[model samples]
Structure formats: C-alpha cells, structure tokens
Target: MIKDEIFFKNREVAAYRLLDVLPIQQMKLEDWIVISSSFGGYSIAKIIADTLDAKLDIMFSDKIVAPSNDECDIAIVTEQEEVLIHEELVKCFDISLDYIYEQSKKNYENNILSLINDFRHGNPLENIKYKNVLIVDEGINTGLTMMACIKTAISLGAKSVSVATPILPSASVQTIESIADDLYYVEKLDHFIGIDFYYDTLEEIEFEDIKKINKGLN
Candidate 1:
C-alpha cells in the first residue's frame, strides 16, 4: 500500500520536475488544441493550454459520441473513466448491471478509435492543420490507448506525436516509448495501483456533468 503522505509529496515533486523538463511552449493560441474529458485530465489540459497560450478544445467521449473530423493542431484526451457510474443508477432498484459495464467498455474503445480516425483524416477544427498533434492523458497503465492515439495521429499525417501523462506505470512507460516521439510523465512508480491512488481528490465524473460541460464549451 502506498502511503498517502509519500505519494502526494512525490507527485508534487514530479509535477514541477516534469514542467521543468518539458517546458510549456510559448506558442500562439491558434497553434494548439486541447482535447480533454470531464475529469482531472481536462483541468490539467486547460491549464497547460493556458500556459502555452494555445487554443483549448475540450472533447468528451460521452458528449461527442462520434469522433471529430475537424482540423486541429494538437489533440489531448483525458483517459476515459473506467468506473461506470451509470451502473449505480441502474442498480439502485436492483436492475441487472452486468451488461452495462461491458457495453460501456465497448463504447469507450469505439469512441477512441473513431477519434483517431478523425485525426488521421485531417478532420479537426477549421483553420487548424491537424499536423504535429499531441495526445495528452491523465495517466497510462498498459499504454494500449496511448498507442492507439499515436497510430491515429500518424495516420492523420501529424509531423510528430507526443504523449503527456501526469503519472504512468513503469511497464506502461516502456510500451509507450516504442511508439511515441516524445513522452512526459510526472511519476514512474513500479507498482502503480491506479491513477487515483496518487491524487488526493479523486471523484467520479457523471455523464450529466459531462454533457453540461460540453454544452457550455459549445
């Protein structure tokens, strides 16, 4: 078990260290696209985009069921949440919840693939080139999703693809290294229990909240 004090301390150190190593670029707002989900990753992406004076484009898997074919310069995705909160609502009255998890998982995977295809096809925000795309997630575990994002970016003719995650499992780092041109991670723990294990305030993002945020952004 990871000690809370030690974990947060290390995370703080890691965050600053990563910022130092991968300094935010002083680029125009038009040059960057921030694609993120409903949770912490979204918050982080927003901050990073602000630091770089880049345009922020928030994308949620739940809101935009289909991938975007718009032109964008950079794309960041908050790793989709694993826990299905909708299951709780169904189970409140003792509804069968077994299939919900499976279906949600399938939807998540499909959405990811679709987004990749959209990027590959040069469909990003209008006026944005969609080349030199960067994929940002909160954390990486197996690196499967990161690899998928990279492949999609490459197919879309992105000049380079970089991955930035706040934390990553050591094994996952190796897997990401094979495909990504550059990688920025805050922490490299050998026995990563879960991404939430490092954060002090981890909470579930409701689908309704996601919808509201997307609507606001639009």
Candidate 2:
C-alpha cells in the first residue's frame, strides 16, 4: 500500500519542506547543537545547521540485532554504550536480556565506537553539556535510535531535546512528542517503509564527509 512518490525530491528538498513548518525563524540556531543520527541521518541536519549557523554533531547509535535475524532489532545502544531492551518484544520473542546485552556490548565496542571516533573526531561529545540538542534524521522507522540519542543527550546534561525528521510513523511521532520538547516533520506515513524508499539518490556519507561537516563548525 505504501508506494513511493517523490514527495520533495529527496532529503534536501524534504529538509526545506520540514524547515518551513518548524519554528526555526523564532529561534537562535547558535543556541542549539544539531545532532545527526549519522550517515543517512546527516543530510537534513547539514542543511538546517548551515542555514541557521549552528554546531553539528553525529550520533553513533544503532540497534542490537536478534540472533540470526539481522532485521529483528531487539535492543538499542547509544554512543556511550547504554543498552535499552525492547522489553515487550524481547518477552514476546522469548529472548533474554542477557543475550541482548551481549549483542549490544559487542555492537558498541566494535562498530559504534569506531563510527563515533571517525564521525565526531574523538571526544567531540564533551561540549554538549547544558546545551539544547536537536536530533535530526531523514526519517524515523523504529524511533529507537532517536530515543537512545535523546536519553544520551539528557544524561550528558542537555537542557532540552528536540527531534526533526522528514518522515515518521504516527506512533513514532507521538512517542517522540512525549519525550522531546519539539517534534518537527513533513509527513507521517502508515505502513512505514525504510528511509531509503523516499529518495531518488541517497548516497553514503563517509568519514570524510563527516570531517568536512565538522570542519565547518570551526
């Protein structure tokens, strides 16, 4: 039922469309630290941060996969290695939290940390304390990463949290609204598909791109 029609001609266009609805003009962008969900999530944050002249950071969070099922995400892991189990799902699927922790610890120690160093240039997370943080992604599929990012920011003493995306499911948007100070989006889709389905040309944002983006912050 979810057929793709070029809504805004990819992430750039989608970012602009979403921005028009956001109360960005009312805010001083310099007061925010725009946090990208990394790679695919960086597209929208780049435009918004550059237009508003805000500092940008990339989050290195990802999901913990269930054994033998790459698409079956059982838990969430943040940049700092905090693990959050999808409790209901874990119970329903008859999986143990211990297994989830093992997978998450492995993911954090192996994959996510390297990405954080490569994307954030080692310890770029220090300056975020007491700042307002905005988490940006092209779309929200499960909303777990955004949740983890929000919790991480709060733990790091971010005064407030906001989330911006071009597309999100209604349930995810509602969840985000409850937790974040603001939730901005252009579309709320049902029968939610992956973020890549919305675009015509989605490219991988490499370490060099992240470095270039971070360099602009200086």
lDDT of 1 by residue, 3-93 (tens): 6533443333444444554646533433555544324455455556556655554333432111222231122232233332323334453
Error of 2 at 121 (Å): 3.9
Off by over 4 Å in 1: 1-18, 26-30, 37-40, 58-130, 207-218
Instruction: Give the per-residue lDDT digits (tens) of candidate 2, residues 90-151.
Output: 88888887888888888888988887666555674646887888889988888887888888
Candidate 2 Cα errors over 4 Å, as ranges: 1-4, 124-126, 206-209, 212-216
Winning model by TM-score: 2
| TM-score of structure candidate 1 | 0.58
lDDT of candidate 1 at residue 168, scale 0 to 100: 82
Instruction: Please give each candidate's TM-score.
Output: 0.58, 0.89
What's the lDDT for all of these models? 0.51, 0.78
